[model samples]
Target chain A: TYTASALAFALRNLPVPVILVGSQRSSDRPSSDSVLNMKTSLAIFKEAPFGEVVVCMHGTISDDYVLAHRGVKVRKMHSSRRDAFQSINDAPLARVDFPGMRFKMLNPRFIARGRREDFQVVSKFSDRVVLLKFYPGMECGIIDFLVDRGYRAIVFEGTGLGHIRNACVDSVARATEEGVLTIVTTQTIFGRVNMNVYSTGRRLLKAGAIPGHDILSEVAYVKLSWMLGSYPGLDRKDYVELFHRNIAYEYNPIHKDSLFPVWSHEY
Target chain B: TYTASALAFALRNLPVPVILVGSQRSSDRPSSDSVLNMKTSLAIFKEAPFGEVVVCMHGTISDDYVLAHRGVKVRKMHSSRRDAFQSINDAPLARVDFPGMRFKMLNPRFIARGRREDFQVVSKFSDRVVLLKFYPGMECGIIDFLVDRGYRAIVFEGTGLGHIRNACVDSVARATEEGVLTIVTTQTIFGRVNMNVYSTGRRLLKAGAIPGHDILSEVAYVKLSWMLGSYPGLDRKDYVELFHRNIAYEYNPIHKDSLFPVWSHEY
Candidate 1:
């Protein structure tokens, strides 16, 4: 979803639309929601307002509607629920009513369709990228392993506000010295990755890790791969610029309302 | 919060109640909630119905009540908010009303206070335990690093449904062979850790990683440290038995209503 959205955003000037869809339950299961979800997604694909990349999934457990989530903002929250996919930190682009075939716009800024001649495809992807989730006791040697394997980019799924164990800092610095592009995203899925809040995060910045502002780790991985693959000859500076830029809506500004959900006093 | 809860739970048969409290915002700020939160926690400590380890924090941002959450089932969800601490998969043990100092029971299974002879301290903690969070493209050398460090146990904060990258399985098996106790918890935070649902999880089981069964990764780390410290002579089998046994309310059965919050459709 992240990569597809980045690609769509990078080529937003084009006339073509990109729709990413998936099933929560298998088609064979009696309780499977796969068929309805697929049909609803197809319906949205044929007539969505924008040419951007979007994810269409069951908005609720019932088959009444499908949500068109901006690909960059969507996430799979549950392991096996039919309504697992949710738009994080932002509302879905629109909701597509099932049987009625009606569209309700949620976010007002969606782009409109344009001429077909502007469409172009950029399919390059570098396989030499890695995503590493940091924990309390991870060893520094793991970073060395990536550098040894000729990995060009590493996206860290770091702890609170984008931090790694202090012991791992030297290795990250070594990786930077060796010219590996490093990025940090928070493991807390809902929040932004801010490397300026703590000394550890500051040290990481000194070690040359770019803070992935509010981008999901998965999206960062996809974006890094897409960037490296699409522009094979770019230098480290160029790569960093592309990594931080909001090619798609991947870097949404944090909203106060989105920080925490409102709770009813009755609970 | 996790360590405090584990310690309190380990000594739960005590005659006195154990209360764990933290302020989301520091005391100096003008909008600081520290004073009210502290007063509410004190009210709970003096009159809570049980002798268990319970977390006392703001039940709501309004300062209307303080929730006494079972230590084992509690987690810090937000980085910087007055209502950051929450009870996962279960309702809080009790809610204490402000001003009036009223205690309303939520969960009916709380244990009552007992004799002083039941109180015993288990202060020994093995410093050799480790916690590792797994992510894509992580190298196996991390496992070897722990084994080489003479670590007795590892708690893994794995991906969805308790999974790690397939390439790291052999390292886990090697650690198991070397007598390191391995446990798996999900990074998702809200759900249970079930290694039976996916091939990667099953493989982790085969590699001797015990499913932590909804125990938060932080709590698991604290529990393992406490267990190893309390019973230094126990072998791998004893460790496994102690790992699964709910000494506290840490492994409560999931409540259906707790799966997701009720969202108002007006958004």
Candidate 2:
């Protein structure tokens, strides 16, 4: 769900020098990303050391441009186009020209993971949950469908700290009656959901929706499904226990810098 | 956006107790939250002498219940009901209930903070963005439509580690051409997106789409919107810069927490 910060975030422990490549213009627009991406990719492959986190894209305002960037240091500035990529929090690793996609090193890099790890499917999805992404001026009773469908779980991405309009109280009630699991997540990108912070948020909490803490709706969905699968026979108390345990790396025991995967103590 | 956690997270700085209140059932249901929430809210409010971060929710299977939970140690188990709340890594501040509630607490809770200076809004969004939740067999070219509609940024909630079908390459190219900032976030809920870890992901990256580390798309959207709004004249480069800066506590900057917000972070 990281719209603009994905590249840098993903580059942390990459096996090789990761280069995020993008275009500010379209290939259909006669001045697209093909050349720039090609050039940047070549630049990183040629200029930067064999391994490190980097971003590769158009380096200059002209078409004959391309650049390689550090993955942790890159971001998207233009919403669309070949040259939209840039270095964030730092400068690029190298530059290149599409004319043979020549490389020019701007910085050096090193890889901690010598080779890429086999990306095993580590998702522990909680099954049978549906999400209701509540929006402004949204209609009420949309959640009723989940209960009708006999879903085991429902995650709501509410505005702010999981606050939904007061119009859907009945829908939530019905879902609870049907024994459907309901969780609340914030629509805002950052920040945790503390039910006691605001009256509106408190109301939603009072309505039976559990705070997803800082969990995103998408993550909640998978976790809910996983929980349902893991301990279907457990009573409410045991179920709660299973839900809270960090069987996977879903919730960090503490908000610390080491929470990242590469530097984490375990695989 | 973190209503309870923020207050609770900040309550670490306050000298008074912070309690998150909720109901196990909605008031609309025959089994509703009114009794539990009322009892719990009152209990925590009256017990404010011992400053702490407490989550107030239905304390028992009975409607007459409430528990003052410590935020750093609480967990929400059920998806939709009030009784699903519990203390995972820490003890609850205090348990309060009507005479008829099903259970009683056996321990006293610890206080975290009392002053209010620890909490504030720190979000920086990229306003020019939107999120496109993807499903298997989804329609192609929807990305192009958004670009045509002038959306500068988009997040694609891909199936696993940021993957999309090759059927929409043209739309992706078009999106890039329009200066549309694009990135891929996984739909698997937890875990980071490793593009080089997969051919499909690598293709998307080559097409100019960035991989969102472990951020959920919903969070990315709000952050992007906020960042975009904050910098009126920011071009793509400025957009990138602002996007990379950690604000609103949305991104797991150094390394993704391998999992997501679902797995409880034991305090």
Candidate 3:
């Protein structure tokens, strides 16, 4: 969901407009070395020197030229070929040929709008946290182990968006109240957590969770670490509030774009 | 990273125009409850339903009664009751319960929009697939066990976005390309595959594998079951392509909303 988003964000926000490209073909294939994929991507990147996002994928032939895809517009075909990538609901920002003519590339990467110094790693992650994924008949003692081991936070990958066995809530609550900040992320990759929508999630929230907001679990762990690390000297009250703040785009309360591109692990 | 986005998206897209007026305080708190929060949210969701998305967190008894938070705007305030949740690079969408009363409440959450469907459960998991997550210094026999079990698919939760130690790659390739449908996902939850980003990711992708595309492990398990079960008769060509399809928003090629919302879990 996010591999491309992070790459897109990096490119669009970068000082230069580097075109993003990926090949569906296994590089190992006899003829599938992504030779054309790389050539086309390089063409798109060199298209314009200014800031922009572009994804180039195989177009028509096994050698069918290529298409320049928009970062946000791109989707996966999963075919194991350069064509595995496709444009989503939106249209491809533009299209171009392979490295045959690098000079013809229109959009060049350029980060001219912002200060260079501000090019900081906007993605902050809470490294100390671990996801104690709850499974059927999961041992409650796991929570004890996490807490005893000094885990700063535990984002439960609950059954739904957020729900754990009733038996586990108090233990979680105890952990949270003990200053081992506990939160819940969904085992489901999609969908939102409406604790009130169900008896289960509601109970967990009431006990003491700072909802994960829609941050992916991996993102949550890293963000939590960043937050915890930031508030090293604060007390419980402060710690709880600190977690709520959008320290790094952690909890984007309003912007949808902030959530999209759900930038995550590198592919 | 997502709880905020969950709310952010709820406000942005869900046609109900549900203004999320929530309280940090629950109904049981001394003079606490979401009463005022609910009232305010209802009014907003009811009135001026378009043009923007807003979030009213208690702005200030500490000037923190409920600041109308924007989707993308978030800042990490170092010290304040509402300090944690701040506007980044921008101001609040509109403050609620503070010095003003704008966008009155409307029907409590009306309805969510754009629900994606048209997918089936991957029930064949019983026949084969397995998720092999890596830990430091893992043994070689682990792969042997899955292969021995005659598993049809083996998904590795790589260190980052689908990366494993060098030692495991050869075995993984030999086992999967040999017909195991081996795939890779990141241990980190948010990102998707970028086989080209690193040599490791590239190598794995080349070894006859598919990238998990940020699909969470929970979904990965079910989806794999569904895919393998449904397409048991197909060739690797068709089988691998199935992984990249956007069957039910499990992995949206692109999401328009900025923040996913506080409710990222999808139970």
Candidate 4:
């Protein structure tokens, strides 16, 4: 799922479903989910209405059904579970039942099937982008190391509400001063980052760090890499705008309280 | 909640329950949870059997009850929800029902109340500990920076299965060589890291990076900070043993699939 959204952004106008599939167990294992996963992917290719990048995987530990999640919003939540891939801060795009092979749209916010006259592919990607997860007492000079190394962008997986420690604010400012794209996403993984709530977050905002609202840190890194690689001459204002654009539905406008998966309290 | 576990480790022989409470909304807000949270905390102080640090917070969105989570195993999951704090990789230690003030132990594993003649508090902490969250294209020199800065320990929030990008393996080895404690925890946050399952993880293990089994990165950072400060001249083997020890229940040996807060697939 980490690279799937990047592929979608590069393809820009995907005309047919691009289903990325993987199995937790090896093919030699009888319990391997590969066959069912591939069948579901093929079923989606023949039946689904959306024409975009999606991750197809087991919906449950049992072979009951398979889920197709939006590529940009999914993440590997479990280390070894067959149903590891999950949609973060969003719902799975569709579900395909096991024996029946019935296709159903779980979320209606996906791009509809269509063809574009000017469909173009930009496969280029810059490897200079980095993701730094912020914690208390982190060394601020690490930011200086990346900026000094000619990195194009640095994405920070900040703490709750999108905050870096007060000590790292100056390093963020220096990154921005060096013309490196500085972005902040929450390390919480399940909520949007609102930098306006706390003083630490506010200081980071003042230092010109772009808050990546509901986007996962991995997705943010990929998006920024693609942007830098695709538009080498993109101006400062346009670059920030492009980073925040919902081109591939990467940014969910409003995360419904019910969207939180198993957090019982959200109810 | 970040500092609660550290405080518990410092005051290892806690005689009475230390209930940490905080509100999502300000006290001035009509919907603030401060009063109810404080009440639940006080209720736990008077009646709960456990004599350890625990976070007391709203268990649900309404005034149903408040939960007491083991301080070493809880995290602020949501940005602003009243029930933001969650017990990670473990169940809440107990619950304090609102109005009824009924107290119940949800998890049986807890330190029982007792008097200790040798009780001592080590309030000292080392600021030389740093946490680095690993990602693709990360600059390896950041590890060098922390090690050269006289940092005592480096905790890495690595990818799935506690693996860093292959490019970082050399730097990790160098840190271990310099007597810097190198620890790796999973970024997945919900599962124990099994380095034996993948080559990347195995390589990290071979590099002398201690796998922080199911320990949250923040907790690892705090525990290390406390360990380094309290025992300044500790030997190498002793430090690793202390880290792996469940001094304050900081390590949850097994993480059942159901412990995952809201990932629907676990069911």
- Which 10 consecutive residues of model 3 chain A have the lowest summed lDDT? A258-267
Kindly report which residue stretches of model 3 are placed more than 4 angstroms away from their true locations once superposed: A1-14, A17-30, A40-113, A121-126, A229-267, B1-267
Per-residue lDDT of model 2, residues A182-266, tens digit only: 7887644234466776686776666667777755455555556656764475665565566555432234323322111111111
Q: Chain A vs. true chain A, TM-score per candidate?
A: 0.90, 0.51, 0.60, 0.96
Off by over 4 Å in 2: A1-267, B1-21, B27-79, B83-128, B252-267
Worst 10 residues of 1 chain A by lDDT: A258-267
TM-score to native of every candidate shown: 0.84, 0.38, 0.42, 0.95
In terms of lDDT, the best-performing candidate is: 4
Q: Please report, as a residue range, the 10-residue window in candidate 1 chain B with the lowest summed lDDT.
A: B257-266
In candidate 1 the C-alpha lDDT for residue A199 amounts to: 93
Ranking by lDDT: 4, 1, 2, 3
> Candidate 3 residues B1-267, lDDT tens each?
122333332232344333445544456776664666666666555554443345555544354345545432332221112223443223344434533555432212212332234212233433476665453334445576567767777767666446777777777777865688877766544335667777877887777668877565445555565677655677887877876764533453532222221211011
The predicted structure with the larger DockQ, 2 or 3, is 3
lDDT (0-100) at residue B69 of candidate 1? Answer: 81
Give lDDT tens digits, candidate 2, residues B190-263. Answer: 34567786577677777777777655555555556655655556676666666555432334433322211221
DockQ of each: 0.26, 0.02, 0.03, 0.47
lDDT, model 2, position B241:
65
Tell me the lDDT of model 2 at A147. Answer: 70
Candidate 4, residue B258: how far the Cα is off, in Å: 2.1
